[model samples]
Target chain A: MAAGTTSSTEVPAKGAGFPPFKTETFPSQIFWLVITFAFLFVVLWRIAGPRIKGVLVTRRGQIDGDLAKAQSHRADAEGASAAYQSALAAARGRAQALAEENRQRIGGEIDRAKADADAAAQVEIAKAEARIAASRGEARAHVAKAAQDAAIAIVARLTGDTVAADEAASAVRAVTGG
Target chain B: MAMNPMEQFTIKPIVPLHIGGYDVSFTNQSLLMVVVAVAASLFLTLAMSKRSLVPSRAQSMAEMSYEFVANMIQSSTGEDGLKFFPFVFTLFVFVLFSNFFGMIPGSFTVTSQIAVTFALASLVILTVIVTGFARHGIGFLKLFVPKAPLALLFLLVPIEIISFLTRPISLSVRLFANMLAGHTMLAVFAGFVVLLGGAGGVLSVLSIAPMFLIVAIMLLELLVAFLQAYVFAILTCIYLNEALHLHDHH
Candidate 1:
């Protein structure tokens, strides 16, 4: 086929005049053109065209959809982070409030117990003072009695005679008072 | 031997026919047109048969061409301009294949003919005009109305109108001329090798220069083929852009 075509098209230097300039050939050329081009347009429009376009449209759609998905994912991540921050702050605030409340309650309990202990000590101190006063009075009484006995006995021995009780008490009281 | 470089472009009748008064014969141009369409269709069909997300080489190629034109439309006319993707893609593939097919040793380049390019160029302009009018109403004609002062409107508006009218001509000529010139130069250089070889042994040795030059031209022609196809598609995009959204007069 190649050889046959090559020979046929080969330098057939026999053609008369410039074929392009000749007007005689325009009709057939134009006719075939109308027929062939119209046929080509139809073929392309009906078959070749939509096929390629379908592929292209689908590819473009896939790309756009992917981009949108990525965008939504990023937005979701951002929303999650914001939620975490707010939740964390809220949790921290709640914990601080609980600690402050606990501290106040404990401090109030300590103050009340301290005041109660001070009052109890005051009452015990009053009782202790009364017991000390009573003991002192008893000791004082014993000492006075001893003085009186000692004086009276000394006087009786010196005089070689016993004095009267009322007189001895009077002498002891006077001397002690003196 | 004297060679005619213009001879390759002849639209010889492979199946001559007549319909009423028209010479609607099947010519080499017609043959290549059908061939280009089929080849393009087959490539797309086979490439996408699996429709794998991770494309095979052939699938990548098909997708690459798809994205290539898609980007062109997007840049020139925005996403809304994608409405013309099928037409533009069809035009791109057809022109690209036809240009490359012509580069083959024994195939006719459909783009070499003025009629073929003119038809395509006209079709583009027609689409722009119709769609522009339908969408924008009389504002479509505002394409010719200049934004300059009334003093220059006399000059700018006329010039804009003429330039707009000449679009199809210029567009058609650009592709046709490039293909025609490249092929003609290659043919001329190839003829030189034969001409030089016939002169003498020493001249035949000198013929290697022209022979190598032909190779170089062939490579250049390959680049031109792809570039011309790109230029055609991009220009169509730009034209469509103007029609879709009436650009400010510049």
Candidate 2:
């Protein structure tokens, strides 16, 4: 009956001034609230909560596993380095021992060679002395013979007598000896 | 033109429903809450579906929310208070998203509603009371009785009991008042911009200042939204912790 009186531009009358404080809407709002809050709580508690928690737990486990693996690897590396160090030290000690042994052997060989050379030089000196003595004796005999001949020639020329060569030689030899 | 800022708080049914003598229509406020709740839940679900060790950006967000609430609960309630993790988590995310949704240009802020906030606050109080009784038996009454001297009980007990009774009101009013005041202030300032610019003079240019202020306030509101959610969740955790600890020691 009032349809003809309603106007389009007229702003419709609102129920209450402040809707939040409106007693009428309270039940519906709270009703929807209970439903929505319950839905959200269920979703979080049953699905979202556990899933996120699983991811977290998995990530943490992964971290802990990786850390343990890294620690083991580090320990292995330290052990390897220790072994390498010990091996190097042993090799250095062996090299020092080898050098000492070689030096001692070479020194002993040098001392033996020096002694042999000294003995050969002494033999050579003795042979040379013997030969010099022999040569000197021959030279003296020759000089004695020559001196007797000269003395005989001189006596003969002065006294016309060729005395016995043996006697002259004997006299020359005795006079030189004296 | 004196725009009514209070009108923005009015609830109108987008889809009207009448059951018996009751009005349970899917109103704008309910719609706001439903959409926010569903959207938030869906976002978390989709983000965490992968559960990647190396989280995607969305997954990081989901994980951040999880850890943020989880850690807060742990600190306040320790391991035991985690029993209420679902409740606290749901409350925090819902209020947080609702606050943020309200920040949108013309969206309704569900948390600003006294009825809604009071309902949530009442739920927390109910949980705390039930939990306290269940955990501590009849000794839970001691909560109203402070550990001070008997003469001091004359002053302390009444204070403790009154404060306890006021918890729900305080909690609800805090969130409701904050959102209500913040939104109203923004609307008032926006109304200023409209009025000043409508005046069409140097005042139009002056509108820029309020516009900029509104932007800054918006950024502040974003922080406030998160902060309020954090406070609500942490407080819930602390209350639950009190129920679990029951006077801290024998």
Q: State the lDDT of candidate 2 residue by residue for B1-250, as single tens digits.
A: 5355666687878898877878999988989999888988998899999889999999999999999998998988788878788899999999999999999987899999999999999999999999999989999988888778899999998898898889899999989988888887787788788878888989899989889989988888888888888888888887788788877834
**Each model's lDDT:** 0.86, 0.87
Top candidate when judged by DockQ against the true structure: 2
Per-model TM-score versus the true fold: 0.71, 0.91
* A157: Cα error in model 1, Å: 55
Which residue pairs collide, candidate 1?
Answer: none
lDDT of 1 by residue, B1-250 (tens): 5456776787878898899899989999999988888888878767877777667899789888999999999988898999899999999998999999999977899999999999999999999899999999998888888577889888988899899999999999999999999998998787788888888979978999999999999999999999999999999999998888887422
Clash pairs detected, candidate 2: none
Q: How well docked is model 2, in DockQ terms?
A: 0.39
